[model samples]
Target: MCSISFLVLILFSTNFFLFSLLMLIKDFCMFIEWEVVSFNSCSIVMTFLFDWMSLLFMSFVLLISSLVIYYSKEYMGGDVNINRFIMLVLMFVLSMMLLIISPNLISILLGWDGLGLVSYCLVIYFQNVKSYNAGMLTALSNRIGDVAFLLAIAWMLNYGSWNYIFYLETMKNSIEMEIIGGLIMLAAMTKSAQIPFSSWLPAAMAAPTPVSALVHSSTLVTAGIYLLIRFNILLCDSWMGQVLLLLSGLTMFMAGLGANFEYDLKKIIALSTLSQLGLMMSILSMGFYKLAFFHLLSHALFKALLFMCAGAIIHNMNNSQDIRLMGGLGIYMPLTSGCFNVANLALCGMPFLAGFYSKDLILEIVSLSYINMFSFFLYFFSTGLTVCYSFRLVYYSMTGELNCGSLNMLSDEGWIMLRGMSGLLIMSIIGGSMLSWLIFPTPYMICLPIYLKLLTLFVCISGGLLGYLISNVSLFYFNKSLNNYLVSYFSGSMWFMPYISTYGVINPPLVLGSVVYKSFDQGWSEFMGGQNLYNKLVEYSQLVYFLHNNNLKIYLLLFVLWITFLFSFFFLF
Candidate 1:
């Protein structure tokens, strides 16, 4: 199965790269129709991937796709349409490949839309009501981002450089570039789900574990960041760069808070993914593309391992998803539990683990960058929160109560699943420095090993302490609405339209959000304007008919004449 899946994935990926190469060749072979519009008269058509950014992105795409395919076999054993699943997954990978390698705006759009469509299908592949609903919401939210991206691309073509080659070539020209860059940044923020755009991610948890593993951790969620880093030249002078930094920092902060309150295990991971993506965005905004890509690599290894382990837990317990109901099974499922704990610790950036190196690098980048003091504080606070929640995740389901009714059993899944997860965990523990060396050329000593170890230890310990306190404290009970107060006002209530049937201790933001959504969706202006126009038209037509109420015979003659005119008009057509 591993060999077969590898072949399928590699074949599809190779096909996309080869096809893109052919297109590039064809563009080069064609005669140039040069008409001088500005500095250079060049045709807009182009396709090339002979660049560092494209190569790096393609490597990530290929690596993650192959891993997910291998992991999916064991996780999706009994599912029907396995072949179709693999096919769509390959298509999804290909779309992203096209997206990253596209040399022109039009080609990029083609790849972007293709990826989005295939991603939507993968989200809803389960064919259930919940999955379908989540899929629709996911698709709808992404479409909003897609609109912004399309508009930005259109703006780029119209007001800025005519050719993408020239756009890249002349990216340093400050003023004109910033305008285009700002639009792209707006699009990126929406696509990556920074702060206000983050609610859709938790909703997207309804997708299968492999889908969640690949898309949430490594591919779809990171596309925006990739675009930003790839076009760093365009964004250098724009205020959009600073905006991205602030938004990303804010997103990391809020996402940490949201993860703290989520009862569902996957939702917690989903929230954490958002936070991590935010951190990556922050790094990219600071012109730390090397650090951003390195973090991306490490994050993919650990997160995919974490998701697969969550999948095993959910599968073993008859599809139980709530982490609140689980506890104390660490002894029973030692392998799975051990692997999960390692991944979580790495995620929380424990020293000697993978997350420690990558996360510390990000912190270093933040400190060195020209970001504002307030922004720095936000990121630090969020880092503290991340450590808290990551620790909670380790202790809650694996260490605490373990009493998940009758279905709870601490046991490992098939060897295939274990093998996949174990490999990922090992990679996470060591993936950090390898990517760092590959990406970062210069070495600057940032912090002492002792201090780094202490930071990780401190964060993990504090998180555990917080979890213990929350579990024991009666009055200070945890709740998501209060934790994600802002999201409750926007995505959780407005976009989701959750019905409020009960009223005890309701969250104010959610309540206000629901009311606002109703007002907008059922507003009077739209109905009244259309109704009034239609009524006036009908009334005038009736009045005109009434004025001609002279004779039925005359009316019949006029109708016959009108039919003749219609026939003549048809004959002319």
Candidate 2:
């Protein structure tokens, strides 16, 4: 299965890569659609928009999934249900592909539902309580988006068709279309784990490492960005677009802060993924769909490699996910460490790396735009937090003493694992420039002041410095005072979203359900519907059992009278 998938992706990537490079592909004048149902001016059709965006996104999904499968061969070799795992991954890939090609709302729902369900299945693949809890969280969080999508479909019903591709232009002036766009942004927010829905993505790290790489790279979270990009024109000129821009910027800032406080290895990267998702979303919300798309592609390449390297390290470290428990392993596992560093630097938007080109463009564009002071500062502050966490992470995992244990047991000769990381490592190094040239040959002509132009550099440097200083300093001496205590703690705790989600959102419903069960299910329902009928039936059965008259004389008289009545009836007839 893995080999066949690999071969298929090779062909797909080659074909689409050339097509994307051909410089001739244009938007379709009329997309090919096949009707599934038609009645009274209403029709549901399977419509595919095979433009550069869909093709490019599909290629990345396939690319990431294939690599994940190849890497999982070694990562999951000893597992008892390896086949099941592979099949689930394949299902996820298919769902993402379906989502990519869909131009109709109904078909998009079909794919959207598939992704949510399959992701739930994958998240719960492990037979542990943590996996089950995480799976429920992941599933329920995404279910919100699923419901929003359905509502958007219902709203689209006013037009008598679900093909949103043809209606993008018409939606601008229509209030109903604006509402639909708002609902879509909500759905996208949930799918992308922005703000209120942010807790699930980190909890989802309970799944196997391969799942993490694929999800963070392309398939699951990107679904939201992909959907919005297709609908970008409608969102560009709406008030909801401003709302989305603000929310996405806050989400990016929040996640970056959260990553600095997180201790779990996979969770840190998961938080980083959240941060990058925020970046993509904020850029899209700002009306730069192409830049967001470019970042999405470049981010996928390096982020997947990052997860693969983390997986390798975890495998070598006996599944210890706490970075605090690891140190100086760079001396032994140089290959894995090297890949980790490359991916991390790319994530930090280092020059010449995959993150640099797209990130720089996004910053430049945001600077040129006339957004408010709050959003402008939030964008750059989030960028600084990114570098802060990266440096802190490096200090914890790669530098200092050998904290976990002696280095005598360390080894990093996993060739297949390294082989998987190598593919993305090369891309992480070059994907940005290749995509920059291909996607935006001419580039935007932005003329910013020196301070505005140097904003990102300033943030990154200041962030790096603070990261090193605080990471080296011991926190035990700092008294818990009102000055920095709340700020420090809040930043690390993901601004308390996890608490609000678990207690505020999840707990109230559970409590209500229990109360309902006790009051209605066990009390009123059982007494009225079940117990009452049961008591009446029991009484009737008891009376019948006793109806023979407890005496012999009574039975004889009744028999004689019955015989006499029978003879009379016969004669009368």
Candidate 3:
């Protein structure tokens, strides 16, 4: 079943790629509308827009998803519910496709909600306490975005159509449109895991690695970026865009810093995904939507490869995910290590690789743009930090002395998994260049000072050096994290994001819920509603029973009083 799914996805991906190329060359777009219902003057229509951007993104998603599924056949071969896992993944892919094609807000909502619902199921697939918590965090965080989309849809109702594409140009300067744009930005922020919404991205690593590779790296998180790209016109010169710029910059910096302190392999990659997402959002907010899209596509290729490599290592390591316990893996798993390092280097924007094409262009553009010091520093420093953590990851996982038990054996003999990764490995090496040439028909003319041009290189080298030196151990070395526990804890714990997102966001509501339950459901509501009504009914029934129980003394007294009152009334008249 997995094999068949893989082939079908690959075939569709190839066709989509071809269609995208044709659309790009011809500069053509097709919109198909199917009317579902009509009332007097109103019509409900489902719309699908076929353009170069959507086609290209769909191709990338399908390609990555197919490979991930093929990889899963080996990674999850031992699991009893492997078939169910594949089905869930396929559903996720279908939802992403729906999202990619739909141009109408209502149709988009269907896809949007589908992504969130399916992702929650996938996240809790393992059915453990940790997985359940992660799933809840993932679901609730995404729910914010879902609500935002719904609001955007409702806001669009005033415009007389749900087809946002029809209004993008005319609504750019409208105040009402700005509200919709802000809601869309909020939606994108949550979906992409920017700022406060970011805690779920790392937590979602509780899911299977294949899901991480497919969902986190490309489809689910990138959905927001794509939506924003579609709605870019409304963001131009808007206050919401400015706010997004600041928030996304901070998000990028925060993810990089947090990844440096993290030890979990999947979590590290997850944070890296968040960092890249920030980069894309910041660029989009700056009105460079095409650049953002370019980075999104390029990032997806290598990031997926990175996750797959991490999965292979984890699989061989007997499900252990801590980087600290892994060492000298390059010797035993050379192929996996090679692919891992390639993906890592690509992530750091090494020249001529998939990431360099998009990342270097983005940096060059940022350097030339007029921006404040804070945004500028965030861009370059985050770039450096990306290199820092990536190299740090590479050092600990691949270069150090073997730290595992001597009796344990490790090999790169998972041929199926390797084959799956190999497909992405080739793409990671070439995908960026291919995407850049295809997406940007006209080259951007970037003019910048030599120092600024080299700034990225300088930070990358320094970051790489710092990353290696920081992780290197010597005879006299002491654990700095242990010595400065507070600092380490703060940084390592994602700057307390898990607490903020879970306990902090949840605690207040939970407390309110408890109070409501005690005061209302269990207290006044019960008393006034069911209990009070019951008591009154019971008292009335008792009186009636007493009156009918043949109580002769009470009846005689009542009759005598009535007769005396009547006689007194007659005499007075």
Point to the candidate with the largest lDDT. Answer: 3
**Considering summed lDDT, which 10 consecutive residues are worst modelled in model 1?**
496-505
Q: List, residue by residue over 1-573, the lDDT tens digit for candidate 3.
A: 899999999999999999999999899999998889999998777889999999999999999999999999999999998999999999999999999999888888888889999999999998999999999999999999888888888999998888889898987888889999989999999999988788899999999999999987778999999999999887778898889899999999999998988889999999999999999999898999999999999999999999999999999999999998898999999999999999999999999999999999999999988888999999999999999999899889888677777866789999999999999999999998888888787877888889998999999999999888777742126866568889888888878888989888778999999999999999999898999999999999999999888899989999999999999999999
What is the full ranking by lDDT, best candidate first? 3, 2, 1
Q: Please tell me which predicted candidate would have the highest TM-score against the true structure.
A: 3
Clashing pairs in 1: 327-401, 327-402, 328-402
Can you give the TM-score per candidate against the true fold? 0.76, 0.91, 0.95
1 or 2, which is superior by TM-score?
Answer: 2
RMSD per candidate (Å) reads: 9.2, 4.2, 2.0
List, residue by residue over 496-563, the lDDT tens digit for candidate 2: 88788778876788999999999999999989989889999999998787775597877888899999
Question: Per-residue lDDT tens digits of candidate 1, residues 1-573?
Answer: 545877666565565445435544453322233333444665445464545446545655675677778878887888877788888888887777777766566667777778678888988898898888777766766777688777767767654543455666555675556666776677677678876666667777888898888887667887878777767776554576688888888888778776766678998888889889989988788777767877877888889888988988888867988877677758767888888888888888887688878887677656656668888887677787777777777666766556666655457756778877776777787777755655554665764456543554565577667755554452235653467577655532323322321132146766887787676545664456766778899999998998689988878898999999999999999
Whole-model lDDT values for every prediction? 0.72, 0.86, 0.91
Displacement of the residue 423 alpha carbon in candidate 1, Å: 2.6
- Candidate 3's C-alpha runs over 4 A off are 37-43, 473-476, 545-569
Q: What is the lDDT of residue 522 in candidate 1?
A: 51
Overall local distance difference test of candidate 1 = 0.72
